[model samples]
Target: MDDDRTRGAGERIADARKARSLSQRQLAENSHVSLSLLRKVEQGSRDATPALVAAVARALTIDVTALTGQPYDLGGRHLDPLHQHIPKLRRALTYWDLPPDGITPRPSAELVRGAEHAADLRRSGNHAQLAALLPALLTETTAAIHTAPAGREREHAYATLTVLLFAAHSVTYKTGYIDLSTLIEERTHWAALASSDPVLGALAAWARTTSLLQAGSYNIGLQLLDRAQADIPTGREPGESVLRMSGALHLRAAMLAARSGDSDLAHDHLGSARRLSTQLGDVDHDGGRYQLAFGPANTGVHVVAAAVELGDGDEAINQASQVRITSDLPKIRACHHYIDLARAYLWTGAKEESLRCLTTAREIAPQQTRHHPTTREVVRMLIRLHHRSNTQLTRMAGWIGHDA
Candidate 1:
């Protein structure tokens, strides 16, 4: 064992706990480790077992990688050679053709359930589990699409595949395979087109728009968003599903517009989101939030995010304060909200508050908070504030595979 490395790990744990405002006794109680063990680890007197490390990481509201100072890998191998799918997926995304590709009428419950469960895992920030599940899901969804009878049943199959492809995009994006994620996004849009539900097809646009925004193709993304929304009818007021779907698109446009420095356009889109969310009883239905999680709470969070992007940090924080009903949001969305607040706090030089928000976000969705680019930027700022010390800030830098 490397004694020096072990001690450094201990220092990180101690620093992370202090950063979160937890005492040794509190962290011990929270992590369910004995106080003596926690103290020893903190004081560099002992090393933690893998299980102990994981528990402590969770208690500290950080990714296990943070404590371990390693990249996220499944079983330390990261990914099995057999588990590699992104390369194949890149080619398949160009023309998604499932063998025996006919949509089955009345797809088996097991088949439907599998797709839903995979989406659930993706949404819940279970990247490791999702990575294990996605390849199998792709195969099953392909099979389900192939077996379905023509017409509505086949449409359902396409819809299922769309969901699975979107899930693929999500997990892949989180894993840092940005190009592969974009391919999956393309595949999702293709699947959505084959599905009869135009609204669903519009919802699929969310995936591509996100990729475009991340890639800095801001105008193209916003243009596509506009085109997709243009296809949806506004006659006699749209239904809840349409409102949710279109409102979700508009919010994406809002964020993109804000990033591009179009404050009026951003606010216009935001106003649309607020109106739609208000009409839908203030929340997008949790079960079917178009996979985008757009609602009043989420919209407020986005407003803050856009404000942060626009350099209105104080205004962003103020908007964030108005988002009080966070308890009902999806964990991922709640995590995003905190990260946005953290960025805003940092922008305003409110370092302690920013750190608090980051810690809170980690508590909500540690993996997402740890891996997200915005969160990473905030941590970089924190490292600077800590004078690039080998203490707490350096420890956090380790979590994200960075050096202070």
Candidate 2:
């Protein structure tokens, strides 16, 4: 697994292609990717885009993680504390239907506050801190829900647990624990439905799209978002939470549309999200209170992301330049923006600028940067283009499991 960290997706793809007895041309045609680009990626001269990775994974009949080499072995780094919590989390999630015995939950109000704090940790990209918090939080929240009276208190407990599960999902999925993250998603949906809160349900739908995107089920993902939006009622004014979730769904839909090659639909969703964000007026996602962050900044980030997915690097760079990442936005979201910007820059042949973005992303959230697949991809790209060894590039490559 440690060596797996040094290998890029192209190497894995080549191995899989050989295992399947298929040539590069056959893979290109099967995956609907350009032969030249496929050759470059396999030859270690090109970075694998998310859209391309997903397509190739589908064509190879393999998991996207199989190519991306996720849950990367970090070899006892400072971030090892995060992985220590996974077993505990898996146990907690496994006991979702049955709260662990001999545990007395705190009052509902205190539990809600704990859930909020977990959400804050997640939004801030404090993966280790968030992981440290969730095992206890999950136990307490589950116990709290079970012991509460069958009424508002119980419903509130379920909602709080749902938000906590979202935080749990963030740590698990981002750390490459895909199976655990999928379980967390299922628990989240169960809790959300139990809460009977349409807003929470919509948030679950939004969370589920990440898996859909990874699997390249774009149309189904779009349909899920549409259904989520429709389920949230708006007979009266669509309040801030409802509107923000709607905007979040549109942002997700835009990504799905872009990956699906529906450029017009992608832009259309981006436009809708922007309008909703304008209506929300500087939604800083205050501690992720609504369990979904949507604002001008996030909308802008999605615009750049959609452009990148559509293979329009120029558009991605242009949109990213116009958008200001305000102070109140979450570090996780901001870090993701820089990662996408780095990719966009790489596509435009702005190698130095791309490395700058990667460094900025590392500064914003070191743990996230260390584990992100795109960060590794961009680092490899920069390494490939460098005629001479760059100290920073070499160090970054080593940290990200690449041989610089």
Candidate 3:
């Protein structure tokens, strides 16, 4: 690699190691490098020869080209052609000095291309590939934040960090490392970095709250959401929407309480959510993108889910059927809607309908069906409903046996 590129790569490696909570000594031990050498290299005080770089790369279990963007065809040529654009991404971030107004002038061509590729990877269920690319992305994005010349630039960095965290969440969720407490902590740190930007701060808070809710920490999630709502600016433009944030926290809280057999708390949260929706006036579908908040359709879906959990199957089926998932919005919310519908149907003894919905949900977003707790619970219930005597059901039985 060229001298500048080599230095950049070294810094990125150092940042990645740090982000993983590894010390230079620890990284040295893991990478089979001397402690002194690792420190020297990280500080940019010593040149990392190609051989040493390769050794470090192997130790980190990442491709050497991932570090330096060199065209290396090692025995494993798994680095996609898309990896070549990373250097340009790095340069664009540096050139812009990390402005906060959402990627000044809408990011460079190369950066936009990289974002598109990353989004595509996310959509294609190539989570492992995306995870492999994340360290470099995180390092570059963090560096841009630190070197950002202005508040706007810093905001940009925070936004990038938000995206990176979501990507990490996706990968970890897929791999079943579902204890997102650590991710929540990291998100909190990033939120602090963007505290001056209310919108970004709210977004960060929503991300953290969503992770907590997913992990079944309903009470804590509700607390975080309350704090975030308190921080939201008053009399903001109608377009500056926090409706989804308010709605999701209450909706998820209601879901959690219901699933855990707390009917009163579930009702309370669901009621609060419904009231908030009414207070927000006509629905703002566009604003829902940020928080995936329960709209009219989703509010009813949550009610159905809670009702099912509370042993009111008739109410669940009725409420769930009233929801129309074929809205103009994205399909993710629809996926959740269908998954909940499946659960309601199963509880109402409509086994065939439940199976059909589950199949459709899997087709729409297999990851959602596989990773989400509510969806997995619905699948397990279906398995039990069919009276399947298999290892998969046996394992799932043990998993949800306590709840049942």
Candidate 4:
């Protein structure tokens, strides 16, 4: 029997179309799905492809999650702290005052070490450790910023604050705390501006652009990147840090462009990133100096991810095969690479290969994969294809909290 969740997807499509006063034929024409097919999908007699679901949602001007519903949402009981912290983080953004009551500005040395440690946890994919550290980091950085009477020390404190908030925004956006993510992004920009450095400010904007990409706001993200790119400082032998920062921004622009279907533009930005990656010192083959990890290996991972996003699965697989995941690579990045490769295999009808990739991802970074939105969708797609024939697939579906 067809489950209500599956049938309910059709119900949402139908309801949304009707709420907009569109007929079946109208929706079919608008979404570019066949009228007969749209009718079947609406009546729940047939399942829709992810692409079809996306197209229909686009036609209706709603989020794809709105159609999938919460049952398919990733992040479970373990993410409860993230859920609680989102509101608290939002309140921090709203107040915009430095140092919550009874807090003293921490020494710059303490703040720097704390940030470096937190970033280490992030690269290792130790999210629980990072989570434990973030709230205090956010508080201490805020206190440090206004503690000094307007000078370079205060500016440096604000820059550190920007980095902390950007890191928070990345986690919140991925874990589905979208509203809080937006606020955190705004705060990053504010801190960057107060830091009185163009590069730092643009990096903050880059973080916000990444959040926009998470929300599928590709056009807006690309626009933001273009604006941010203009701020790339021009002068005297731009050193390693400057190169890494510039490269990170271009790399993200490549991804947004790829998703938007501008292949030439995407490749152009990708080339810019590749050039910068070479200049990023020997340590970066693992991932660069910056938290964003702009390096050769990471750029290659983005190339594969970009291919997957552009629906070029064969290209994605071909590129993925060449990309090596070394131990030094950030587990967060390496995990996403496996997920991207798995999705590519699925696109090419290599179901078992896709399953293997998923298994590897779970082995490498269980929590991140289990909580990721893309991971859920990939598992759902696999279930749709192999659930009846593969016992392992069924078990995997259950593990990911899906009932196929």
Per-candidate TM equals 0.74, 0.96, 0.58, 0.84
**What lDDT does the true structure give each of the candidates?**
0.70, 0.86, 0.56, 0.72
Query: Lowest summed lDDT over 10 consecutive residues: which window, candidate 2?
Result: 73-82
User: Which regions of candidate 2 fall more than 4 Å away from where they truly are?
Assistant: 74-79
Q: Which candidate is the best by TM-score?
A: 2
lDDT of 2 by residue, 65-92 (tens): 8998888764644236677777787777
Query: How high is the lDDT of residue 195 in model 1?
Result: 87
**Candidate 2's TM-score:** 0.96
Q: After superposition, how far is residue 229 of candidate 3 from its true place, in Å?
A: 1.2
TM-score of 1: 0.74
**Pairs in clash, predicted candidate 1:** 102-146, 103-147, 103-148, 103-149, 104-147, 104-148, 104-149, 105-149
Kindly list the per-residue Cα lDDT of model 3 for residues 74-99, writing each as its tens digit: 11222333334334333332322233
- Compute the lDDT for candidate 1: 0.70
Q: Indicate which candidate wins on lDDT.
A: 2
- Report the C-alpha lDDT of model 4 over 1-404, residue by residue, as the tens digit: 22533334577889889999999999899877789978876775544444566678888888765765532333453223435555455555554573577777567988988877776766666655566678878887887776777989888888777767766776665565666677887888888899887777777778787656645567898888788777877578876666777788888898878876788888998999888877665345432324667777888889998888777889999998787676656888899899888878877889899889988888888767766655665666676666467877777666666555
Compute the lDDT of residue 118 as modeled in candidate 1.
76
Pairing residues by index, what is the TM-score of model 4? Answer: 0.84
lDDT of 1 by residue, 1-404 (tens): 22322224567788799899988999999977789977865664444443355567768767644665432332332232323655555544544584533433344566667778876777677766777676655765676676678898878778887877887888777655665776777788788899876776787787887666654467898989999898876679677777778878888899888876789999999999998888888654554625667677878887887796666789998988787645556777788778878878876888778878988888887777766656655675566565535455565656545455
Give the lDDT of residue 225 in candidate 3: 62
| Runs of candidate 4 exceeding 4 Å displacement | 1-15, 18-59, 63-65, 68-81, 214-216, 279-289, 387-391
